[model samples]
Target: MPFTVQYAVPMTCEDCTKSIKKALDNVEGVENVDFDLEKKLVTIRGESAPSQIVSAMRGIGRDAIVRGSGRPNSAAVCILENAQGKTRGLVRFIEDEEHQIIIDCTVAPTTPQAQQVSIHASGDMSQGAMSTGEKLYTLGMTSKFGDVFSLITRQSLPLMNTIGRSVVVGPPSGPTTESLAGVIARSAGLWENDKVVCSCTGMTLWEERKVATTV
Candidate 1:
């Protein structure tokens, strides 16, 4: 259901309203924001937790209260790992119209090179991504300095298939040879050594869409 959550925020002028609006704008799943200066009420309509909205308000040096009902949506999460299966980051996955998926993660830099993130076959990070063969699909590249990765794909496949799968972020493939090891090596530039995933949204963000709708 489309839900509305109101907050008692501190606002004294247009600038405050603007600041509040800007802060609220970054929150995911937010649909609409309205305010009543007289009551100091900030009404938000969306699907995300009210706590997120409240936290956004606090981010701008304002305090807020959840003046109404708020609930969380369905989500999947994973811990990103390196080729040796060491923890590297966290990944959160959400849906894009049920046919697509958005992977959002705060990753620690695992390599000196730019990293490519992709959905793979195996969920086990121990085998690293070697077990998770095939690109399945590539989300995109993350910078070398541990940046936020927002990879989106309009998947014709099912989300359930991704459940036991893996999201690997690693350096682009290196040189390839005709050797058997090389055959298993890059998998045609789709595989790399520094691949990592953490313990895990895009296209148009869920925050940018109608909150009531879900995949």
Candidate 2:
């Protein structure tokens, strides 16, 4: 099923928009692309993975941050972290109208050997990934490029049931003592998050983005 995703891309001129549009045009699964130059936003209606869309924009020397995706109550996110509390990467789940879930994930500092990713029954983190309960679903294996590992796939998992569960990434054989894990949480849907500044932190979106990138 086709869904909508919004991205904040800085644009300084009409040429920038043209370049972005042209680049996205070549991206498979993209159905439509709309731009808001004044707000520096691009709303894409398609089935393309968000990572792929961002890569396309980067191909043209532009950077894009996902603002929102999917419909209300159809999106979720997880921030993967090691037991030491350092963020390793992020995973996003967007469910389409037909209930198919799109799993988009990126992690780093992984070995060349493929890693197995799965969802656990527990969200407990007192002992890190070890505390999570039995694995409920194996999402898939991730391919490593350099030190980073990325995976984009679709699954039939029910998004609502997965919230508060834990996602673990470990050796292909299964999760080990060194596996990374994170609790799944709800995320903003398309046009659902439009705040320029976070009221809790008083930081602008770009400022928050900078901090996120560094971590």
Candidate 3:
């Protein structure tokens, strides 16, 4: 299970988040972390008991208090990997009913060249705009939690649309003989004519196939 911790600290910069993350990273059994500066919230994952987490946070010189017992909704985590099963990067989609989902980028343990990300959707994205139809809005790496939260509340895009929109993820290396074959296997030629859209470098055919299947 996941949990959240709220703290009352003077964290005026990213450096503060980084410092807290570094401190938490030193604790054993921690798995993942997501910190928001404006909300002053930190979500952490671990297999250990909650008491241990509370103690660890206290050791970091912050007044930490448990805030929630579960992972936040509409948060989708994409784990990118290379041919040898090495991690590459993370692409997270945070959705809300008021605005388009925001995407966040983070480096994974392994980076691949020529990597592609496929997005599968069931509903039409054309209702918003021509480009908006196929292009799902995702927060850029530089996105801040406060900014994204504001956008979500202002626009009113249903969070459920993300699950229904036809998965349009890609950046598959053009229509090469081998890459085409992989797409055929996964998308059944639905994306045969679509252009590769990902910006990852050095991604291999196997990785592309894997991404196609996953998306």
lDDT of candidate 2 over 1-215, digit per residue (tens)? 68777777878789999999999989999999998887778988888877689778878877575666657888788988887887877787877656777777677654556688899999998888889889999988887533367676767898999999999998756666778899999987667775656799997655654443243
Q: For residues 109-171, write the lDDT of model 1, one tens digit per residue.
A: 444455666666655444555656666656566643213322322234454456666666664
lDDT value for candidate 3?
Answer: 0.37
- In model 3, where is the ten-residue run with the lowest total lDDT? 180-189
**lDDT (10s digit) by residue, model 3, range 139-212:** 21121221111011112234444544432222342211111110101111111211222356555322442333
After best superposition, candidate 3 residue 123: deviation in angstroms? 50
Better of 1 and 2 by TM-score: 2
Off by over 4 Å in 1: 1-20, 23-31, 34-73, 96-99, 144-157, 174-215
List the candidates' TM-scores in order. 0.47, 0.80, 0.29
Output the number of the lDDT-best candidate.
2
Q: Tell me how far the alpha carbon of residue 185 in candidate 3 is from the true structure, in angstroms, after superposition.
A: 53
By TM-score, how accurate is candidate 2? 0.80
